[model samples]
Target: MLLKSPWKPRLADTEATVAERLVQALADDIAAGTLETGDRLPAHRELAWALEIGIGTVTKAYAILERRGLVRGVKGRGTFVAAYQARQGTLIDLSINAPPPILSHRALARSLMAISRKVDADYFTLYASPAGHLEHRRLLARWLETLGLVADPARLVLTGGAQQALALAFDLVCGRDGVILTERLTYPGAITLCRHTGLRMRGVAIDDEGMVPSSLAEALDSEGTSRRRAVYVTPTLHNPTTATMTLARREAIADICRLHDVPIIEDGVYGSGTEGTPIAMLAPERCLHVSSLSKTISPGLRVGVLLVTPAMECLATTALQALPFSPSPLSCCVIEDWLANGTIRSVRLELKREAARRSELAKALLADRTLVSHPDAYQAWLPMPREEADMFASSAASLGIAVTPPSAVMVAPEESDSGVRLCLGGASFDDLTRALSLLSGIGRSTRPL
Candidate 1:
């Protein structure tokens, strides 16, 4: 009988160097157990021929694997897997709302190098305008246009990230002692911001299509006093529920806000390329669109864009100035390079593909459960009773899996609508599969709280 081939590398076509790609393929196989501890890799020439690359590239890849302690090579023999031992108490975190790790170090290095070539003393010494650099603003405006949002660059402001953007929006629309209407189940960060700023949040009812229009209208109408208030909404891949508002739904919400003359703080952090035109387009005069590259691109980039109506631009910029600092010029340079060279597009495409794949996997694993998720969302919502959600979260924690607790997303602690959100992007594919299986099994058993 013919012996099985030593190894068949499967390279992912990400934005990485050939040597880096080769190393990644080998490392992935070893991690996935496709290559055993003692499995000998094919000869360098053999792999180079099979992969249609230079022998030097293959050699460089092997050196990297050895340095990473994933493989070992013998002079007379060939390279063998030397998989590292698993840590004793490692935790698999599934609570962070982030994209899968697809942006390679090589890609970031290339961007950094490009930035270095253009760096000057002013780049470090000067404080950027409250809205960030003018060129950066212009670049972001053009970028937003690709997502179906048209805006004047003058009205665009660069923030540290979406959190800061939200802060700026909240300050501009509703200062201290104001009320902001949000989904009954909303982002935890928003809840924290409200508490920290002495602003009150009123929860609005939601359905499969996000915030209900009638509920918002009622909330607006119920404002007995003349205190300032605004509507904050996430219309695409809503946190914890994966709800994307329909175009008609968005229009209705916009009309209500317009009728009430309430400004909208549109949190589009997870809104890039998911679904629906931004509500900002419908009511350009009163929407403050808050979005960041942290969700779609590298979070470490710390770059966010805020698009404000012309009337609100001055206030927004002033609020940013009151803050201690703005997005650094160095970070802005990376953003510019990424946009100019199409690196952002490549990373986002890979991220979307990975997110879709993970969502499918989660859906299949929990087919019997009530899971609310979108094909492009990095998280899946498993709606359950409040007690049941809490119990499940505890059980998952015991099994070394961390999930977002229902309370983290609830606008009010006493509300009955509750569920735990499983973020699919933070963990490895294998770890995600294992954790979901445990969750499915836990759901079936009558475990006590």
Candidate 2:
């Protein structure tokens, strides 16, 4: 006895094939609330008969729906709508590594209104220096002071975002043929930038405390003294591994770089001022510190700051000038207002609370697994071999939970240490919980194909 399904979706009249149209029609009904949770669907044969389509077409659509987490099937019972479909179950993307939204629309509106009242037309029409306006530079220097980085305004160059800032740092230290030494697993952007600039990037070993000093020394020694080289490190809250270097390790890395006469590009994009002292402070003469407000404040706010030594100041400014344009003056003003009025501080506090909550949730849900995370970090890493990591990510994606693959974060293709990164900050708390629960189950399986 088949239960009658109330859904009678008419496929959209378009170029899509019969199967694709069926999938889209069912998806539309699910999203529009026409089909709801626990609502039983017609049997494959029944739907095929009613739609005058092949049974295989109906079967394909149903399989697609199940993989998308839109529907589910029981062993004895027929297929039914999944619970996720009722509550915005389009795609639970855990791939983007960013902080959760803590700022409200009202607050953003108020800030924008305040900025409009404070600035005049010249603020928008006038072209500023390549190193940014003097006042804006001072504001950034002052804010960095709160983070224990005593910066000089003259050495600071504002860029579009941390990504741009990183490119500037790479230009300052490494030229076209220069070599870059980084952790075994590093930020994906660095890998892309190296490839674009025709820079040779070599992977050094990393442990629980970020980059290993001994491996860094070996890599530097192998490059020899004649080659132009730089060492890039995220000493605080490393991206994929979530490893923060201790003070002693930072000193060791700085010492090695100094001995090799190589500059250091320290990326603190994930640091919140609480993570240990930056490596730049220890090797101020050769280190270029890069950070931005994307993670803590708003990802859309494209403002970043680069701190360079006095010796590299002129070269960095030249690099900035070489770019086609400068960072948005309006965006700079917004950051200035936020910093001066302590809006950024308040926002940071809120972000801390939200991130901590999510991190705890992820930790609790994946407690049994080998998880690497920090109390204040928005991302976590599950260490595994390459083959297993790929299998795990593939399985999670099939269930509509997107995660960062091991290849995206690995510096070297054949690097023995590899794993997938779980971005907990992007999804809602409920969705995060559900995804993590599913991941936990998938991890436990010996073969999660």
Candidate 3:
């Protein structure tokens, strides 16, 4: 009879120590879901002998796992999955894009309260018109001026949020079967919007600087066959990769869009933190800019401001007709009061401070590791060795940390890479710090084959 081979664990070439090997086995089992929540693991000596490792190494590995709260040891019984193990799941969530917690500012809170007192009616009673409050539009215009994007308050339209703004823009720009050009790894929401509307979305190549000029040119050249209508971009402080294109690249893209007679929808959601004139400032005549108070202030507000060229006012108004009858008047009033009374400025300063702190923490934790991010960005892009992105994400999840592997944010479903995006801005500083600590440990820990 043939003898069954002894149980063996796959180990990375760089990690040869028996202690690292044992840790790898535990990590692999956890990731594979074989050692599930509350599942009792084999005794230390049994596992060590089965994997052909020294008992001392097994002891050390178990000690490390215990410290991380992955397993528990009892006086009379063998080690088992800790009762608290379920709480240590996933970190570094890259799936959802969320702003950091708004640092509390007494002045802003007082201002909002003051506004609420003067409104006479409850917030729900005021949001009956789709055009939003007139005062809110005026305040938004003033804020736009500060950002160097001049606009007339009469032309501004408020929506639920940036996604709503994009949806409205789509309703105005594309009819049934219309086509739009977008970067290969563009925001997923845009893709979904096109799909829902029966519109076609064509992907264009992008370089480190952003969407390549040549790719846009190629897509535009196929006008008769493809009939590209609009182009969308996240120009400054871009999502996922955190890439910020230079003025020269922006001008080139603008010129290309102008040449092709295509409208450009610029998502300036992350631009508030960056100090420079927006691409909208350069091509306001042909660009439709969508911005929000969520990233800079509070997402719960759900107010999105749309800035359009004077000639496009009618289009914007018509598009707004298809959306909810009106935006929340209370949200607009609060934003208006915040902008006019200097509360917005105070809130922005708080955001900058928090962003700076989190960015620094991320850099410190991932030092010597390859990460692409901006000091003010809410997320970081990590390129890992081999195709271990999924494995790393699974390991992090088992550790109570959430992350998005490359497949989650791919521009083209066919394209693949070994990278993941880690968000740093969504949790409290203490929670974020703890998550980062766990992430750093994983980065330093051994990987299994």
Candidate 4:
């Protein structure tokens, strides 16, 4: 009897598109002498029907193989195995959120030298305060003011990175068996942190503006005020999906949270090049704003700043002290110098232009696809059927380019996202263009009705 076909894939581990997986399995079968060079594969719809998958998926897979010299199609006769050629090159990464490195080396060098000359060397020898140095905190307070908040030095807590800052914020406020409410889809880090801490998280419904106020109230009311610790949000240039909550939405959210005595954990990591009034500004007593210089500056620097009110300062600092490491002294020195001399300000302006250019490139290429993004945001979202998008993303990965599948960032795994996040800022312009070109070709591929 003929060996059973290996085209049926366990997708949880497979990185090739379902169609590509079939091509690959067939190729392997031919090499192993299970199928000869002259053997004919199953007809497209017949094979798709057998696999219980879409014929469009099968068509896309076959098209790719035909172009790569792995298969040949005849008008009346079904497709047959052909010679396959190996592809080469490093994988072009588009899966990560890291922006293209654009820091001025000269500026960094000058800042380092200035720190050594102007600042006392003794400061470096001592451990920084658990929260942060007073002067450094003061400078950070001034920086926050530009964002529309009148920050107090005591209210600011510095951490290694925004991830750490967020962890601390959650740890400080959340007790055991607590539930943290958040937007249905949110930053991946928050989901991981909640799982690690054994804290339950319930996703609230959201519209284009952001978390629906009614949904927020209903979730809070159901959970009761006692076990609900906080409501986390990415108010500006929200990750994966660029949903910036309007000022009115922010106020409405604040009102509901305040009524339930629920604190807000606002993430602004992607806010460097964008402008939006923060939730913290509207309800300082109820919000903790978290941000970093990673996307705007160099990720290598690893400086994150947290803004809280004086009433919450002690708890925030206690959480800060609980960590094995406080803020890095060197990173602090760099941040302090950059903030004081207006270097960071100038860099942000330049980076803002770069982000806009990258975003435009994405819009131009994927205009036909369902896209969700901001002009100044570093990533864009494309809505596709969940299985189709997953298969497409895997094929993109197999072709040596990486794109983030929606499930990676989904807060509720069972709730379907059915899309991918195309990170525009991670690669250089040329690299981004090429990857996007390949991606667009996939979109432009003809689909079976």
Candidate 5:
């Protein structure tokens, strides 16, 4: 039988470093269970010849792995699995929203190498200024131009992640005892932020198109005495529900914000997936667009970019002043190189393909269920029979399949829905396929209460 190879190596240069080859070999050993917890790895010379690399390279690779806590080299013996296995339990974690499948690490490694060659290594070691690195800002501005939003690099703030940006936006727009508006069922992060900041949040009703314009208007009117300052929304491929607002709805909402003098905090984290004009494009002067590389690029690179209007630049700056620095420069450089080269496009294409495949899998598995989802959505919203949501979640979890029940995402404590969200983009194609199959079996079975 052929041994399984978990390391997806890239064939770029023929003279690949010994470190690179050993990394692949080590990864393969870990995947094949040859290198279990406390299993001793071969010495530098042995691993070097096994991977066709120099002894020094093997040492360097082992050092890197050790730094990552994947191995530990003993003085007398040799490198071992550190008495700690990193690949424990299910690799498929469906709780968080991650980027599309990273099929190969070759492109990422190549990008890192390119950055090391071209950019100053020391630049990545330091903290970025408030406005971020000039080159990074320039590249981000150019990319934003593609989306039809002309960004003044000075007005842009590089955040640790989109969640930080959201927190900053809340700090700037909402005051203590002030109200912030969001959809009935929205991203949990936003809700949690409001709770943390002591700011009150009003859940606006949403339909198939998104937050109802009339509902927003009504909320604003009800809060007539208090300041109705900001509105948060995910207009494209929205989280959980996967609803994209129509152009007409976008215009109406923009008009409302303009009339009420409310700043619209548009969460465009998933904006890159769809091929439509952004709400920022509709009203750049009134919209503060927040996006991150986590959705499209690697999540480990915790970098988020914000585009604020000239009017709101002072507010944006003030909020960013609290954080006072940019994210990891090494991560930014990696992402910049990927975006500069054609790697990002290729990655996106692969992601889209993988998303399509997963969608097909979901359709086939949940053929008899009622689910609200997009073809490329990371999660699916399924409305089951009353009181069945909790049971379904429990049953799925019992089978080692994690799911987000309605209670987990409910806006109000008393207003729980009779449904659950089954995430499809959490694991590899095969793992997701098996999980979905098991979930489908559960969805189809009728249990007596």
Candidate 6:
């Protein structure tokens, strides 16, 4: 019988260097246990031949793996697998962008236990309407009062998450092969969703205040009045580039969208540190607003609400049904309790304070360096020399800290700002401080790429 091949790499072809790709291949295999603990990787010359790449690239790949402590160079004995990964290292995760859980597990458990006793068993077991329970939506409207919007429960829909809300909004606004207008740098979730929907995007340039209205007006005019174009925006604490638009800027964008009769999708997920009313409030007739508790409470709740135009309300309901919407009764019950007992407002207050503190910490840490962020934002954007961007990010990842790459937030390749989005949430205050210190140092180094 033929022997099993020695460490064949099924690497995905991409723009990443051959050596970087090779390291990723080995790392993935090691993670999957396909490459056993003691099983040696193929020799550099052999791997190069197998991969049909230069032998030098394989050498670099092995060196990178050794640096990450995933393997070892055994001198004359040849490089051998050392360990799957180093356990001693403290991986300060600044990658994931989510609100840190401010509530203790014990407190949350007590709340859930109390809720179960109060709620009917059948109510919790049965599926809710696609738009969720009537009372839950009324509470969602009342909750919006704090944010300066007086939404009607009749025009609202409950979604599993902001992503679901956004999906339905995209589906309602755009058709097959539709085009959406967005800021040059926007949310990655929307970017990922558009890829699946065949939704083409036209990017508008932004200034310190936010997406330039002139840029948006020009793009809309170029697309013509009859074109099915929808504009998506994160007005306050705009993702990856914490550039909050002024109220005037919001109105300017509203006028342009209204003039062209284009629908506006307002992503209000990060409503925590935002100011003024949502853009939906500015142009209620043509806007679909999405808000979620994921960034405020816990993602486990998976609760989201949409403020859609009354005429377009059924679109969301229909889209939710098509997606087989089933809102989590357990989570809705938790929201009910939290909203009733003032727990939601208290948590929001605490998270707001925490967010401000973290933002200040980041600013202070990188005071000498360049960082674009709002005082209340959860992340800061760092722009880098285009040529140095690749090495800078690769180096940081190699050192065990994570950040949002520019490619993730950019819509067009030409709009790719060579930088990273540094999220301030997720990690503890201490871990954040340490990570920021290392990041500041790494960022200061102007070494050749």
| Candidate 4 lDDT trough over 10 residues, lowest sum | 6-15
Question: What is the lDDT of every predicted structure here?
Answer: 0.81, 0.82, 0.70, 0.74, 0.70, 0.77
Q: Give me the displacement of residue 377 in model 5, in angstroms.
A: 2.0
lDDT score at residue 101, model 1, on the 0-100 scale: 86
Candidate 6, position 59, lDDT: 88
What is residue 230's positional error in candidate 2, in angstroms? 0.4
Compose the digit string of candidate 6's lDDT tens values, residues 65-88.
Answer: 676566787666677766533223
Q: Give the local distance difference test score of model 2.
A: 0.82
Flag the better candidate by lDDT, 3 or 6.
Answer: 6
Please provide, for model 1 over 122-237, each residue's C-alpha lDDT reduced to its tens digit, 9 standing for 90 to 100: 76787768788787788888878767788798998887888888888888888897999999999988988998899999999999999999999999999845899899999999
RMSD (Cα, Å) for all candidates, in order, is 17.2, 8.4, 9.3, 6.1, 16.5, 4.7
The candidate scoring highest on TM-score is 6
Candidate 1 segments exceeding 4 Å error: 1-88, 446-449
Model 4 steric clash pairs: none
Query: Which segments of candidate 5 are over 4 A away from where they belong?
Result: 1-92, 125-127, 384-386, 416-418, 444-449
In the range 1-449, model 4's lDDT, one tens digit per residue, is 33334343322323334665665555445444455555677777777887788989878877765654456887777787664321256667788887666776787788899988778565577777888778778877777776666778888887778998888778766865778899887787888888888999889887787789999999888887667478998888877788888888888999998898888998978775236788888888888888787766777878788887668877776665666435677787787788878888887777778888988888898888878878778888886665556556645654457788666676766564557888888788888998888788667442222
How far off is residue 168 in model 4, in Å? Answer: 0.9
> Which portions of model 6 show Cα errors greater than 4 Å?
1-87, 225-227, 414-416, 446-449
Q: Write the per-residue lDDT of candidate 5 for residues 1-449, one digit (tens) a residue.
A: 22332233221121123454455456445544566667776666655565566778767776656654557877766667654323236644455677666746786677777887888766667656676887788877776665556678887888788898777777767766678887877886887788778888888888887889999988887788556468899888777687888889989999998888788999988776345667777888878888887776667768888888888777666655676647777777776777777776777677767766777778788898877877666777786642466456544544456676554555663554546766677587778877787777777543323
Q: Specify the poorest-scoring 10-residue window by lDDT in model 2.
A: 8-17
TM-score (C-alpha) between model 4 and the true structure: 0.81
Q: Which candidate tops lDDT?
A: 2
Using TM-score as the yardstick, the better of models 2 and 4 is 4
Give the TM-score ranking, best first. 6, 4, 2, 1, 5, 3
Better of 3 and 5 by lDDT: 3
121 Cα displacement, candidate 5 (Å)? 4.7
